[model samples]
Target: GLSSCFHRSEGFMRGYPRVRGFYEVLSSCFHRSESPEGLEVYLHALQLLTTIHHGIQTLAVAGGTGQALWTFLCEVVCEDLCQPDDPPFVLQEQKGLLVHALAVLSVLYACQNQEAEHSEADTLLPLVGSMLRVLQYHREVSSGHGQKEKKEEEEEEKVDEQLQALIQTTVEFLSDIITHLTKDAVCELVTRGYLTEKTCLSAVGSLLPQFSPAVQHLVFMLSEADPQLADTVRKEFPVSLSPS
Candidate 1:
């Protein structure tokens, strides 16, 4: 329904006023439908809204709309999209929605972070946790059960285009967040029970040789923020990561 609606309204997202309703519509649809395919349409449309300067500016609405949107999207990503009980194969099944949600959230998270720094801790841990979880699943499915390939092109052939984009976006966003962690921020994540050995292991599994530099940097940060956590991560893969 929305796919057709979006196609019919060719220039609906031109002005700021026209784009403001998109978030409200997305929130309403997700609550009503709760279907993966339906949510995909909403996230895709929402992603498009963030592509323009005018739309992004409108999305940066202060206490009125943008704040609500930022909060809603965090829940959408961390809780609604993929659940802990779901298996790794779900990542492949929901590639399109994952790509759309993550891409748009990255944009909105940046906007919200700039708008108000207070909620960073509130949202950052769960948001990064979800991104890492998705990435770990991507790695699990993409590996094709011990069918690893050395050549980049050969590896590329195993995953479809949408999934390739999902993996790339996940790594990029995770890197942006991980590489900039303050010692205090890392401490907060640890104290709040978000940064633990299991989380570190997932981080290692996804990052490893693909994101060696980032993993290495994260290790350095952890060493300063909390040595026990850093040691746990380091022991998991001693050879793969060296201090930066």
Candidate 2:
């Protein structure tokens, strides 16, 4: 029955006005969930559809259905998934859900941007703030500790691995949206004052070693534009710029 459910939703996503039906099904599934499994399946289905061309086209349509879906994702899904105040143990336990949620949101934002819906930017602003806060927490927890018992040390390692994975996912998500990052977007994020130098450094940690030229150039240009922000970013994590 569950397999049939997924198949039906998949088909719904492949046809006209697909997102509306898919979103309704996802909403219904999430509401009926008494356990994490329902939510997990919902996210899995969302992620799967996002990978399809038809799904992207479906999501790109700006309408009541699209708006509701995005709103629920930013408000409900992300809120429940990311708890910045949660300790490493809690976060480690929920890493799978968090990763899926972020990946889904990332794909949703990509589609939303394709539709050129500037109003959606307002909805996404808070999501970015939440992401930064979560990233900051993960960075703090993962940066090595002084002394602990053997079990504690092992647990810390597990947390570190999870946090690293999340950091990488968040970095890639931000990278996707960075191309259209306007001066206003930068100002809005800065004014929110939730983002700190540590957050920025953590955001880029997983991206630097790949030697992503576009990211490097973007950072270099940003540094030139805002030397103070550059100094703050470099204070802890010095990203070596490759000349090419």
Candidate 3:
């Protein structure tokens, strides 16, 4: 029954032979008359993706299946439903999808074997950038700051907590992946602007308390690659502060 459901639905349209079908479904979800129903169907597909991710270790060894699922999920989230004028869903449902999708991708990246030696940067980096953009858009829409004043104290604190948690999970996952990657790959990610100052700060603040010494050192190296991030750290963590 599960296999039949996946076969009949758009979820099966992920790999090379069915990618066009996958894109068509996504495009239809974006612009068809049955957009809301399409969205629900897409959500169902994502749930199936979660199941596939959970079975990766046992059923799929090379990680290609997981990567394909990740790529499709990213396309649906970042490309289709993530547009400016997209219809609203229940907020909690939307957040659940975003969080789960992100968490699953993190797991896939972390679980790759050492002998694989493949670069997932092409797949993972865009997902991270898109997630950041979604978070930024949500913050903007909810807080109404419009690039003028700094976010209000209450608003900033709330968003900072949510964003920090997401960034922490992502960074922890990436830190694990970084340990397995070549130094040149790590340096390339830094130099190519994939790891921005804001991302570095948020990740460092959240991850420093959890990761081991070696991971922390890697994070520090990545953080130091951005001069603006160093200045931010100095300002936020100044020495000799007066007692409150």
Name the best candidate (by lDDT). Answer: 1
- What are the lDDT figures for the candidates, one per model? 0.71, 0.62, 0.50
User: Over the full model, what C-alpha lDDT does candidate 2 score relative to the true structure?
Assistant: 0.62
On residues 50-104, what C-alpha lDDT tens digit does candidate 3 reach at each position?
Answer: 4553343522345555555556666655665454344322222255445545665
Quote each prediction's TM-score.
0.74, 0.70, 0.52
Clashing pairs in 3: none
By TM-score, is 1 or 2 better? 1
lDDT of 1 by residue, 1-244 (tens): 5445444443654523455476777777788754667777778877776776656777776665667676777788778666666677777666787788788867866776552642476776777777777776776666574233344786456656777788788877787677667778778777866677766677676666777777887888788888887888878876333455
TM-score of 2: 0.70
Which residue runs of candidate 3 sit more than 4 Å off their true CA positions? Answer: 1-54, 57-59, 77-94, 114-118, 130-172, 178-182, 212-215, 223-244
Instruction: Indicate the TM-score of model 1.
Output: 0.74
Could you give candidate 2's per-residue lDDT for residues 1-244 as a string of tens digits?
5344435665654453456776787777767747677777676667666676666666667765556777877765446666555554445556666676777778767666544553355666677766665666566655643222346778768866766777777777766655455546655666666345666666666456663553555455446555577566556556544422
Candidate 1: minimum summed lDDT over ten consecutive residues — where?
A: 1-10
lDDT of model 1, residue 169: 82
